[model samples]
Target: MMTTAAPFRPGDATPTATIRTRFPALRREHRGRPVAYFDGPGGTQVPELVARAVADYLIHHNANTHWRYPTSEETDRLLAQAREAVADLLGAEPGEIVFGANMTTLAFHLGRALGRRWGPGDELVVTELDHHANVAPWRALERERGVTVRSVPLDLETGELDWAALEAALSPRTRLLAIGAASNALGTVSDVGRACALARAAGALSFVDAVHYAPHAVVDVRAIGCDFLACSAYKFYGPHVGVLYGRRDRVEALDAPKLAPAPETAPERLETGTLNHEGIVGAAAAVEFLASLAGGAGGPRRERLGRTFAALHERGQALVQRLWDGLGGIRGVTRYGPPPGRPRTPTVSFTVAGRSSDKVAVALADEAVFVSNGDFYATTVVERLGLASEGLVRAGCACYTTEEEVDRLIEAVGRVAPT
Candidate 1:
C-alpha cells in the first residue's frame, strides 16, 4: 500500500520551488549549462515518488496476477489501487479504467474491437487537428472493414476546429467519432463535450484522445459524455503507460479479441496479455502526487485532484501567456495554435522564417534549452498548416517549468533567428 504524503490546500500559491526538487532530471546539465526542459508536450519529467513506486513494486511485489501466492495477491491489490487512482483523476469508476502499453497501442486495440461492429456505408468521424494515433487507427478500419471515414476541417488562421464541418460529417451511418481533447502539435483545446453530444445525437460512439489535455485540466468523463477516452501516463509525470476509460455498458459489449482462459470482463476483455505492473504502480503514484498539490487532508482524492488542476490551470495560463508574448515579439517567428487568452494547454508551436524546425531546436539544445521539433506524430496537422516538410518547434510548460526557463528559450530562439 502507498503511504499518504503531506496534504496541500486549494487556491494556495503554486509550490514551484518545492515541486522542482522532486524531479531529478531538472538538475541535468548539457554543454556546460543547466538544462531547461520545455519539451513537456512530448513528455513531462517524472517525479521521485513515481520512480520509487515503480522500484518498490519490482523489488518487493514482482509477481503476476491471480494466484494463491502472496506476491500474486499483492499484485492484484496494486493493480486495483492503480485503477482507483486513475479513476479518481478522470471522475470514472475503477472498473472503467484499462491499462496498456501506451495510447497508440490501446487506440489500435480499440479500433479493431470497435470495427467488429462496423461495415461498409458506416462512417467514422476524425479531425484534421488530431494526432495520427487517433486518425490512423480509424483509417485502418476503413481499409480492413470497409468503413467510410470523414474528417472535420481546421481553421488555420485561428488554430481552432471548424465545428460546421464536423456537423456536416455526422450522420446516422456515423459509427464512431474520434477526436482529440487538445491538439498535440498546436495545443488547441477543442469543444469535446459538444462533439460528444453531437455524436450521441447521431447515435454514434465517441472516442477522445486526452493524452495532451489530462496533464493540464480536470477531466470529468461524465461531463464530457465520451463513450471512450485515452491518455498517456508519460504526459503527466509518470511512467510510459496508456490508460483507457470505457463506459461500463459499452466496454461489456465490445467483442475484443482475447484468450479463452483470460478473465472475461469489461476492461480485462480489452486488455490483452500481461500488463506492466511497475508502470501501473508508478501511474497511481503520479495521480497521488497531483492530489498532494491541493493539500486538503482527509478529503476525497477526486476532490483534491480537482483543486490541484484548478490551481495548475491558473499558473499554467500565466506561464503560457508569457511564452506566447515573448515568442510573438521575436522577429521572423510565426506562432501557431490559440492565442494566450484562448482556452488551450500551455504549449506553443512556432517556426522561424528561413530556418528549419530541426535546426532551430538544435540551436536551442546547445544553450541547454530543450524543445521538440517536427510533426510530433500529428502529421496531418503539420500538412494542413502547409508545414509538411518543415515541421514546427514546440515548447510546453510543466509543473516545474519556470519563468526563467521560458525567458531563456525565447532568448535562444531570438539569437538563432535569421537577421
Candidate 2:
C-alpha cells in the first residue's frame, strides 16, 4: 500500500527564538522601530556562523589552490569540504559542483559552452516565468550562434506554466530547455522534474535556475533529472557566491573557454580564474547553518536538511496564507500569483491602487518594514502582467521571520493601501 508522508510539525525543527539569535541583522532599528525584513527573496540576512566562516578563512587559511605551502593545502582542503557540503545540500557529487561569481555569470558561461555545440538548425526553449538571468544567456546564443529560442507562455490566472504551450515548444531540434524552479517575484513553484522529463523525451538537455527555490525547499538534482542547475549562495544567507551543478559526463565533455595552465578537470575546467575562496567557505557554512536548524535530528547531513526544509515549508505555508488573506482584505490591494494551498514559496507580490510600487515600498520603509519593489529581474512577468510601469511590491518570509513580523508587514501595507 502506498502511504503519504507525515507533515512536518514545528517541534521537528529549531525554534524561531533560537534562529533569531543567529542573525544580528534582526536587531537593527529603523526610525525607532524594529526592522521587519520581508526582503528575503532579494537576498537573505547572513547568520553569524556564515560570516565567521568567511572571516576565519580570510584571516588564517587564505591562499591560492594546489601549492605545496600549508595555507595553500588548507585552502584546497577547505574548498573540497565546501564542495562536499554543497553536494549534500543538493544531492549531487562533490566533483559536479562548480563555483563562480553569481548564478547569472555561471549561466552565461555555461550557455556559451553549450552554444558551441549548436548551430543554425538548433533550438533552445525557455519560459516566460524565468528570471531574465536564465533567459538572457540562452538568448545571447541566438545572436552569437544562429539558434532559435522559444518561450513557453505563463498562465496569468493560475500563475503557472501552460503545459500545452510547453509541449508545443519542444521538438527533435530543441537542444536545451532553460527554466526556473521557483518564481522569485510571485513565488510560483514549477514542476521542474516533469519539465526535465519532457526535455529528455524531446532529445534536449534541461537547465534549472534554483536561486530562489534553494532557500525555501530542498533541492534534489538527481530527482529533478536536469542536466545542469545553478543557484547563488547569497540568496541562501551565505556570502555572494554562485554554484553550478552539471552532470558528471556533461561537465567532463564541456568545451568551456579556459587558459591552458588552468586545471583541466571536470569542475575546475568550468571555473575561471581564482575563485572567491572565502565566499566558497561561507557558502558551505550556510549549508551547514541550514542543516543545523534540524536541531537534534540524526543521520546524515542530507537527511537533516530534508527535515529542516520540511519544517520550513510548513511554516512558510502558514505565513503565505496569513499574508494572502490579510492583503486580500485590504481595499484596492491586488495580489499577483497563486493563492495559498498551491505550489509556491512564502514570497508574495502585490500592488496597491493609487500608489506606485516604489511609493509603496518607501512607505513601508518609513515604518521599518523592509520590502523589495520592481520587476526583480523577472521583467517579462511584469510586462506580461501589464504592470510594466508601476512594477510590484514584494515581501518574502525566511527562517528568521516570525508571525509578529508578518502581522507588522500586513499592518504597515494596510496603512498605505488605497481606501
Candidate 3:
C-alpha cells in the first residue's frame, strides 16, 4: 500500500498555467491559433525537463551498462534510477521493473514466455474492452501453443466490462487472465483489482495493461494483486518506453528467451538487449517532473505522486464533464463510453453525424484543436460499438489541459458538427 499523504486541496494544487509553461509544445501555433493538444491519450507532450534529461544522457553519459568506465557506471546508475522511478509510479519494487521498446513488445514477449509452459487444456481469458495489445498477445498464444483463449464480453450500453461474463469465463484450466486497467478508446477504467481477485480465485495469474490508465490514476500493483502489469512511459509525459512490473518469483521463473551471455537476473533477463539508455533516463525524469507538480509537498516520491494524481484527477473530471455536456448539447454529436460521474479517465470519444471521424478530426485540426481519430488500437471496442467505419474522435485531458483549451475544443467541434 502507498503511504498516505495529506489530501490535495484546491489551494495545494499546482496552477495549470505553471504546468503549461513547462511543455514547449504549447508554444506551437497551428492555423494561427495556439494548438490545444487534446490527443494526450495517444501520447502526451513531453515536458522540457524530460527532453533535457534525454539530451543530457545522450550528450554526457552515453555508454553501455556495467563496464569499468565512469560513463558506463553512470549509465547503470541512471537505468537503476529509472527502475526506481517507475517502481514508485506503479507501487512495485525497483528490481521488479523491466524496460522494453514498448508495452506491446513486452506483452508479446511475456506471452511467448508464458505460452512455453501451456498447451491445449490451458486457457487464457482476454477482454473485448481491452486494447488489442493485451488481446492480440495472448491470442497469439492460442495459435502458437494451442491454448483456448476466451474473451470476456463488453457491455455496450455502459462501455464497461461484462462482470458476469468475465466471472463465467474464468475456470480451473485458466492459466492467465489478461485484462486492461482501462479502455484507451472509451476511457472506461475497469475494476482491475476485482478482476485480479477473480483471476486469483480461479488459480490463474493476472496481467494488467496499464498503458492508458497510468496517465490518469495512481496504479498500485500490490493493491490490484496482479502477477504482472505493463505501461508505456509515452502514455504519460515521458519518452517512448515501456515498463513492466512482475512479481519477483514469477519473473525469475519465466523461461524467457534471451542471449546466452545476457544477465540471468529476473528483470534484465526479461529485457531483450541494451535498452534505450537516453529514453530510460528521460522516463525517470518524467516521474520526477510529475512529482515536482506537487510543489513543496514533502514526502516520499510516491506520496508526492499520489498528491499530484489526486489534483490532476479532480481537474480532469471537471474538464471531461464540460466536454461531455458541450458535445451533448451539439447537434449530430454522439458521445461514446460512460458519461460523466462514471469510473473513467479524462478522455472522451465521439462521432459527428454526416462526418467521418477522420473528417471531424481534420476540421478540428484546421481550427488548431488537435484530436485523434480511429479505433486507437482498441479495435474490438470500436467494432463492438458498431463504429467500424465511422471510428471515433478522441480528445483527452492532461495535466496541462486547460478550461480555455477545453472550451476551444468544444467551439471548434461545434463548427464542424452538422447543423
Q: What TM-score would every model get versus the actual structure?
A: 0.97, 0.98, 0.98
Q: Residue-wise lDDT of candidate 2 within 225-336, one digit each (tens)?
A: 9999999999998999999999989998889999999988888999999999999999999999999998774669999899999889999999999999999999999999
lDDT of 2: 0.95
Q: Can you rank all candidates by lDDT, best first?
A: 2, 3, 1
Q: List lDDT for all candidates, in order.
A: 0.93, 0.95, 0.94
lDDT digits (tens) for residues 49-130 of candidate 3: 9999999999999999889999999998999999999999999999999999999999999999999999999999999999
CA shift of 291, model 1, Å: 0.7
Cα deviation at 25, candidate 2, in Å, is 0.7
- For all candidates, the clash counts are 5, 0, 0
Instruction: RMSD for all candidates, in order, please.
Output: 3.5, 2.6, 2.4
Could you say which candidate leads in lDDT? 2
> Poorest 10 consecutive residues of model 2 by lDDT?
3-12
246-311: candidate 1 lDDT, tens digit per residue: 999999999898899897887788899999999999999999999888743548999888888988
TM-score of 2: 0.98
Segments of candidate 1 deviating more than 4 angstroms = 1-14, 296-298
In candidate 1, position 82 carries an lDDT of: 98
